[model samples]
Target chain A: MALKFKTPMLDELEKGPWPSFVTDVKRMAARKPACEDWLGLMEMSYEHKEGHWKHGGIVGVFGYGGGVIGRYCDRPDLFPNVAHFHTMRVNQPASKFYNTDVLRKLCDMWDRRGSGLTNMHGSTGDIILLGTTTDQLEPVFYELTHDFGMDLGGSGSNLRTPEGCVGMARCEWSCIDTQALIYDLTMEYQDALHRPMFPYKFKFKASGCACDCVAAIARADCSIIGTWRDNIRIDQEAVRAYANGELVPQAGAHGSEKYKLDIKAEVVDLCPTRCMEWDGKNLKIWDEDCTRCMHCIRVMPRALRPGLDTGATILVGAKAPILEGAQLSSVVIPFMKMEPPYEEFKGFVEKMWDLWMEEGKNRERLGELIQRMGLREFLKACELTPDPRMVNTPRFNPYIFYDPAEVPGGWERDLKDFRSRHQA
Target chain B: MSEEAKARIIEWVKQQKKTKHYFNDLCKAVPEIKMMQAKKIINELVNEGRLKYWSSGSTTMYMLPGQDDVAKEEKGMN
Candidate 1:
C-alpha cells in the first residue's frame, strides 16, 4: 500500500520480527482518514519523545455514563481529522465468537461513521472501535445497539465486561459452562456495566478448568476456575493404548517429540501429589491424594476424565499493579455449583460490590482494597466463612489480633488490676 | 423507589455542603437501597442534567451543576 502520510518513526516499527500494529494501522489508513491522522500523530510522538494526546472529557451516548473514552489530539490544528478521536467499546459476545455477517455489518458501520480500526478484543474483552469524532458517537451507538443488537461494554468506575474461555462449546476438558456463566453475569449486571457506580473498575473472567486458558486467576477481580470433588475417571484400555504408543501423549499437544513415550516418567512422576502409578500392565490412582490440578488428565486425555460431579472454585481480588503490586486471585469459595441464574453467585457479587462501593477509596482496585483492609475483614464483610482451603498456606506467625469483644471480661479490668499489682 | 432514593441522595449531598462527592457517598446516603438501584438513580440524575460528573483522570465523582466555584471555595476553606 502507498503511504498517505510520512510516518518515518512508524515505518521503522514495520521492520520488527513480530507482527506490528503500525503495519496494521497503515492498512487501515488507506481507507480511514482518521487512521492516517493517527499515524501522523504517533510518528510525531515518537519523534518528539512525547505523546500528543489528552484524555478525559464528557462524551458518551444518551443515558450511558461509560464505554466511550474521550480522547483528543493536543495539536488539533496539525491533525484536525483526528482531533476528537474517541474510543468506543462494544460489548463482545461470550467467548468472542462472531459470525461473518455481523462482523461485516459492524465494519460497514465503522467505515461510514468512524475509523475502521479495531482492537478486536480488548483486555476486558470489549470490541474496542478506535478513533471517531464526538458527532458520530450517538449514530455509531445507535447503529451498534439498534441495528446490531449489541450494547457497549464498561469503562471508568464500572463493572467491566465479563469474559470466558470457549467452554463446552469446543473443548473436551471443560468441566463447567464458562460461556453460560459469563453471559448470565453480563446480562444480570447490565445496569452496572453502563453506569459508573463502583469506586473502581471490576472485572470477571471464567475458565472452563484449572488449566486457566483465559488467565482468569491472574487478571480478574472475580476468577471462576472449574474443578471437581470426585475422582478422575479412568479408562484402562485407553491408558494401555497411551502406554503402548498407540495414542500420543498429551494428544500430541507438545508437538514432534523425538523420544518415545514413558508413562511412568512423564505422567506418574509428574503428578503433583504422586497419586498415579503405572506398573506396565495396570494404572493405579489414589484419588484422595489428587489435587485436581488437571496435569495427569491433560497428559492422558483419552484415559482420564474429570469427575462426574463438577463445579468451579471462586477466587476474588486479583489485579494488575497500580496502588499495590500485582496480585493473583485467592480462593474465596473452594467450590460451588455453577448452574443457570446463579443466584448464590449473584448474591456474592452484590455483597462484594456493596462493601467496595461504601468503603473503598477512589481508584482503589478490589484487590488493593482487600489488602488495605485485611482479608479477614473482607471475608467478614462479604459474610464468607473462613476456610482452610482459602489460603495456600496458613499464617506462620502466631501474632493474631483478637477483638476486645471476643475476650471474656474484655480489656477493662485488666488495666486496673495490672496497675494495682505493679507500681503505678 | 428510584425517585425516593434520588431525593434522599440529593438531600444528603446538599447537607454535606460540598460540590463533589464519591459514588460511595451516594451509596452511603441511601444505605437501604442496593448499589445497582442507587446507580440507576444517579445515572438518571446525571442524564437529566441535575447532576454532573467531575473527573480527576483517575477518579470520577458526582457534583451538582455549576458547583465548580463552590468546590474551589470548600477546598480553600479546608
Candidate 2:
C-alpha cells in the first residue's frame, strides 16, 4: 500500500495544469490496494508504450449481453490485484440529477466492491464504474439493482443509453419536456438497452431546443430537438429596453461590458435567415422567412419567446466519424408532438429499428446504412412521407437514374429496342 | 406461447450447430413472435443456462453454451 512501485513518468502527469487520472488513481490507491497495483500496471504500460489490458471471456450479469466490460491483465503475474479488471456501466438518471444521499451511497457501494474509479459520465451518458474483478460483478450488480433501484446501461451492439437536456426543469426556451421524454423511452426500451439487439450501437438523444446543449444532432442515431411552428413572440417594451442599452442582451450570457448590445448590429444582423429588421424606434421580424435557429430568441430572451404551437423535430442517421464521415442528423419527421406514453414516437423508433435490423450489414451504423441504401429507400421502407424540410436543397446535377418500373416500358425490352434503332 | 418461441429459437441455433447467431437471427427463428417477445425469450434462455452470450469486443452474438471458442479457452477463469 505504501508506494508499491516507483512511477516517475506517472508522477510527471500530476504536475500539469489539468487534473490528471494518475492523481485520481493514487487517491483511490490509498483506500484500495488493488488500485495501487493498477497504477503500477499503468506506469509499466506508459514505459512500454503499449497497454497491458486485454478484454476476453464472459463477464456480465446473468441474462444481460452488456453493461459489464470484461478486461484482463496480460501480465497478471506482476500485478495480481488487477488481474481481472472489469468495467460496469450504470444507467444514469434523466439529465443526471441525484441527491447527495444517493450519490454518497453509490460511492460507498462502489468503494466496497471495486477500485473506486469512475467516469462521472461516459460518452454514452452512463456512469462508468471502472476497475472491478469478474467475481465481484454479480454481487455488485445485485447490490446496485436491489439496494439502489438502478440498472446497468447498454454496451456492445445494442441501444446505448438515451440522454436529454434539462428541459422544463430550469430553461424557459425548452419547447418539450426533454427529461420526461427520455425517461419514457428508457423505460419502454429496457430490453434493447440491456441486450444486444442491433447490428451495431444505436443512440437516442433529446435536446430541449435547437441550441442542442447535449450535441444530439451530431452524435445520436435518432436526434429529437424541440421546435415551434408559429411566429416568435416579441415584447415591444423589452425590445426597446434592449435597444436603449437599459437591459443587457443575451440575458448576460456573454459578458455585458465586452461586447456592446447593438440591437441592429448584433441581434438583427446576426439572424441566420435575415428575417429581422430594426429601426431606431421599432423592430420588425418577417416571421414567414424565419427558420427558427434560436439565435434571435437567445440574444433577446426577455424580448422574444417561442410560439404557442410547440413540438419536437425528429431527425435520423447522425453519428460521429467511423466507417463513414461525421454527419449531422437530417430532418426525418419535421415536427411531431412529443408527449407521455409516447406511443407514436415509440412506434416510429421500432419501425426504424426493424428496417435497420433486417437490412443493415454487420458493424454498419444507421447513418452508413442510410448512405448505402439512400434516403429515398429509407423513407420507402419506413413508410414515411417525403417532407420539404428533409433536404437543404434539391439535387442540382441531373444525372438521374430511373428504375425499370418507373420508365415508359420495362428495362428488358429497352436494351434490345435501343440496339435495333442505333446499330446492328 | 413464449415456450414455443423459446423452443423454436433453441432449435434454430442447434440446427446451425457451430454458427454464432446474431440477435436478429434468433428473432428470425420464431417468425410468428414479435421481435421484443423473441428478445425476452432469448434472455430467459440465457438466464436458464440453455444459451450464452459471445462477444467480439464490439459485437455481441449468442450460441449454445459450449460452442464458444473464447469461453472454452478461458474455461478455467470462468
Q: After superposition, how far is residue A123 of candidate 1 from its true place, in Å?
A: 0.9
Residue A235 of model 2: what lDDT? 94
Each model's chain A TM-score: 0.92, 0.92
lDDT of 2 by residue, A1-424 (tens): 4689999999999996999998889988887888899989989999999999877556788878888887778887899888778889999999998898878888888899998888898988899998888778999999989999899998888888899998889889999999999998899888888778788889999998999989999999999999988889999988888877777788887777434468878888888778988887778989887778899889889889998899899999898787889998988898899888888888889889988987788778899999999988898787887766787653444344456775687666577878988986
lDDT of 2 at A82: 86
Model 2 residue A10 CA deviation (Å) reads 1.8
Candidate 1 CAPRI level: acceptable
lDDT (tens digit, per residue) of candidate 1 on A1-424: 6765688778888895999999888888887778888998998889899989877656677777678887777887788788778889899999998899999999889889988888888888889998888779999988998999999988877788899999989988898999899889999988878878888888999999999988999999999999998888989998888877787788778984434458899889998779888999789999977778998888889899999899999999999888889999999998899998899988998888888877788789989989989888888888998776776754454345666776798785477788888996
lDDT of 1 at A404: 78
Give the runs in model 1 whose Cα sits over 4 Å from its true position. Answer: A1-4, A256-259, A394-424, B1-21, B25-38, B54-59, B63-78
Alpha carbon lDDT at A3, candidate 2: 85
**lDDT tens string, model 2, B1-78?**
888778888998888856687787778788877665676788899988888887654678788878755455446555
> Model 1 fnat?
0.35
Backbone clash pairs for candidate 2 read none
lDDT of each: 0.84, 0.85
Give DockQ per model, in order.
0.27, 0.45
Candidate 2 C-alpha error for residue A418, in Å: 8.5
